[model samples]
Target chain A: MTGLPEPLRSRLHPLDRTLDTLETPAVLIDADVADANLVRWQQRCDRAGVANRPHIKTHRSVAWALRQLELGAEGITVQTVGEAEIMADAGISDIFLTTNVLGEAKLARLGAVASRCSLSVVADSAEIVDAAAAAARAAGATITVLVECDTGGGRCGLADPAAIAALALRIAGSEGAKFGGLMTYPGAGKRLQTEQALQAAIAACRGTGLTVPAVSSGGSPDMWKDDGLEPLTEYRAGTYIYNDRALLSRGTATLDQCAMTVLATVVSRPTAGRAIIDAGSKALTSDLLGLDGYGLVLEHPDAVIYQLNEEHGLLDVSRCSAPPSVGDRVHVLPNHTCVVTNLFDRLFIVSGGRLQGALPVEARGRSI
Target chain B: MTGLPEPLRSRLHPLDRTLDTLETPAVLIDADVADANLVRWQQRCDRAGVANRPHIKTHRSVAWALRQLELGAEGITVQTVGEAEIMADAGISDIFLTTNVLGEAKLARLGAVASRCSLSVVADSAEIVDAAAAAARAAGATITVLVECDTGGGRCGLADPAAIAALALRIAGSEGAKFGGLMTYPGAGKRLQTEQALQAAIAACRGTGLTVPAVSSGGSPDMWKDDGLEPLTEYRAGTYIYNDRALLSRGTATLDQCAMTVLATVVSRPTAGRAIIDAGSKALTSDLLGLDGYGLVLEHPDAVIYQLNEEHGLLDVSRCSAPPSVGDRVHVLPNHTCVVTNLFDRLFIVSGGRLQGALPVEARGRSI
Candidate 1:
């Protein structure tokens, strides 16, 4: 073949205009709704006499994290050291990494970020504490360590309260480590058990003559019940800002309160009862948190995205009396907002049914 | 606090070095195995007297697409106009966009792409054909249109063979449009039915005095049985390049032939039978595809990743005779490799247990 012509640049119409002109398969975040959610959570935490530390993993935008901090959040919580690094580079001074930082290489990376920011991390074992301590010493940084206590969550954490205290004490005795407190991501709807577990861990720490600086417990499902847990000095929640179908199913937030949505266009209607959309597992995500479908279709409430390929959403329109036609736009509230945020590199900030600006997902794909 | 020291630059070590020093949650592709898969598939298609057009949606890497073309692939197939744009920019001449292009904006974008490359698309409806025709005429381009016939996939496609032929005739008669052929993504284990469906559609096209230039049928599960279908002159398969666990479960491929694996690290051991890895839904993807778990632990054959959060994979090691420890590196074979490729920004190309280079997933996040 001869020399080819100049290839056209496929640019998705910018969100600088109205939402009607924006492209499909785009992540649209209602900034007003997000701000309202932020203020509501802040006021709730203030009433409960607790600190509000929103997890940055939900949005992963430095701009949004700054907004949360401006809205009276004490600090930010990150899931990965990579996220902490990104936030610290953006001049954030306080960050709490909720995941356990193990391995010498990772702890060293964590120590580098902790040196610049008042960083605290959760550890469930003695090996993790020792690694963090050594890394902090090498960096000449004082690292705060929170012993992760597993109340009912079957994920990572120390189940024994005494073990948590022992780990905290180990942090206190280490060269460059300070015992911050206890932190637990409680199981869904296990508020009472989480409170009891944190209380026992705090008592065990007190018995060792170590004052726990902050006792943290978090889960969006039980965010409103923070006042019932007397020992928790702080609450960290990521999904509350961009509520999803999972939270909606739990009645934690109303559908109107959901801030994030996926804007998709009906590309094809193969059958009378089936419509294919531009968004699929890549755009909407495949996180089925015990919900009926992948997401909630806003335009056609009864329609279900029963299946998804990598690029096409299989919309089951059997339940919809009047289903969407090809070329119609639709909004999909994903089942889990956190995963959806990480799936896209940019999100369109929309408010009042108009486009604001695009926010880059700075910490997206920072899994390490 | 006093003025903090200079923040260390956070760098997830690049794949320029060996694979042994690579980071976790990294998508690693064995170049040798991938090239072998390319040659094997090409040879299989040649033996069956058909053209091989592997879908670039699997890897979404322009470099790999070029390599496939270099290995005797007739052309490449993409799932989106965004993908077609990227492939054309990389000097790829022939591209078959498998999804229907609808709406004025998308049709305009599709026409722009068609102007610079030999672009072909599949359509199941007359509206799609009319849109393509109008867009091509405006762009001064001749676009090839393929009628998509639904055999049993129940996704996007016309179920009626006569309807497919009618759409083909419309394309043949439309301004700046050419009737390319018929296309169908056969359902898993439904190759015979897909063949019958395509044969009927081709017959209908002939009855309408329109010659179907190319009859295409594809699916990774039924790729080996393509020779059984006599009417097909072209075959498209994507997942065959990077065989996933779902394909392995379907008995389409063995574990050794799987070219793609998510390299993760054991970050925590919460219980004796549970090890939490750094790779979660964001890294490994939660596409179960009706499998036992999220993915297969390649190191620990009996261990199952029973649960996953956005950033943590819960490993159930009860069935394993020997389990991995915290900080141990493990390779996970994702259930669906295509989605896994879209989740990451770059992939480490490994061969002979050493990192060769980094392949950018250029077409990733191009769902629009």
Candidate 2:
């Protein structure tokens, strides 16, 4: 849609029609499907009496993030200060940054955003808490600090509940900073451990005369079960809004629920058993996510994208009873959809098989 | 560089001199190292008496492409028509698009680029040739068409020599196109096979009264061996300019020759044996290239980036003799540098351990 010509615009079809309008290897967001996916996830949270705070990392579009907020999302979650700034610029008032915010540069930016919104960040160490407090004080803003408990994620967070409580107390005592609560995005099979760690940290903080205002826990695979985890005030899940092949493999969603897909054209058919698609690592992404192939070709489900160069996807069609030919467009569900969203500058929004419009990936490449 | 604050800009460091300025997870390009890499690759081609045409996909920076041309590169190879258009806008006249150009929309764009520059493209079938010729005729521009031969890559090309000749003859007979000989990016360890296939195709074309003028062949691994493939007038290599971990693993480049690296800060030291860097799949990329890890930790060569989320590189530092602590800046040589280049919006240019400036990845998401 960025450089799409007028003549080709008419041939663009979001449905299963011949994709002749837009160029091959385009990220197509089925608006109807995406809307349904969003509504379904939000409704599940609502039915369970829990707040659905969607993570903007899945879409990285300010428009869609605003849409989620409009759909009764309590707030939104982001991974970086840049993303939080983007959301703040879009007038999203309440935002929670899930990653540990460190460095004077990042903290200063976070403080600036905190001045304009109800901004909160996670911290697992006193060093980061002190840095955030100093930045917040310099900016004359109050920053909410959530102690990130490891809970068996084995990534980032305090492994011990005492460490988490100590960090929270340190944040409360630091200038221009307030203790928010505890947060953790645990591994797929560590939900119980994550809940236990959060509960233990909350009890320890309460014993020190500090109130745990919010408890945040989320992961798309365990999103539905988050409501069962006591003391979790909010749930944040990103990929549930646009279920991918990884989610589908985890039985989190079905193929029909995959809202975001890469529309690729078979550029070359070199052999009877093999074909090449224009969507390669650049489009589908190199995030294998332990999947066998790069993505699942929706048109020929049996086709295995066994190889990917920078701009070419090598499809082994030996398993497919009917393989695609050159010029035929196919839909690919990437193994991981979040990284795919970052790779594109724009997403062609389609509704019920028609190209509606395009949305800029506003927060894309805002990794820092 | 897009939204970086003035204070934060000075904090960026690729080495361990207290990374307080530019934020972590930045793409750092050492100017001296990059210039040396460029000159070294060019000299190798010059000494071999073959034209060096570096692929623009490696950096996708117009300024860098111009530098290659200024440093005596014959022409630059691009992976997309959009890239060629970008090069043309930058006053780069001679361009060869390595990928097969198809679809009316892309052909129209290709024609627009050809009208502004001396442009040639590869094709394995007559359909693409006819489409391209039609578009060229419509634009009143003469375009060169190269018959892409398989030559053991088995990706996108005509396998049979007779089939290659047929396509070459078709291009020669086309009204708005001229035959520009054969081109192939051969597979690893297939230089002899590529040479024989090219010879057979050339012989077949000559028997049909078509004179093949330029035989273009390339692969970074065998770039130095192109002179051995007789009649190969031009050589194209992408990764030699940056020299990723994949190239280093293959012994194609030494550590000193590697010019590009992602500078990341150790944001979380969760355990004694593990540290989490700010750079992840978004910065370092997930292209394993059959490597054991995501990237080579430059500061600690024994460190392995065992896991990566979107914005977190989980580094296994147990193998490191003196493991890095939180807030330490470390340079990462990504497994595939080209993909890493595509992920960032800007590259922080460095000269002798100091930040020089930032260069925009102008052609970052021109995947369409």
Best by lDDT: 1
Q: What is the interface RMSD of candidate 2, in Å?
A: 1.1
Q: How far is candidate 2 from the true structure (C-alpha RMSD, Å)?
A: 4.8
Task: State every prediction's TM-score relative to the real structure.
Answer: 0.95, 0.94
Those runs of model 1 whose alpha carbons end farther than 4 Å from true positions after fitting are A1-17, B1-17
The candidate 1 chain A region of ten consecutive residues with least summed lDDT is: A1-10
Task: Give model 1's share of reference contacts.
Answer: 0.68
Local accuracy of candidate 1 as per-residue lDDT tens digits, B212-325:
899987778878863456788888999999899999999888898999999888878888999999889988878999999999999998998998998899999998898998
Give the DockQ-based CAPRI class for model 2: medium
**DockQ of each candidate relative to the true complex:** 0.55, 0.68
Maximum-DockQ candidate: 2
Ten-residue segment with the worst summed lDDT in candidate 1 chain B?
Answer: B1-10
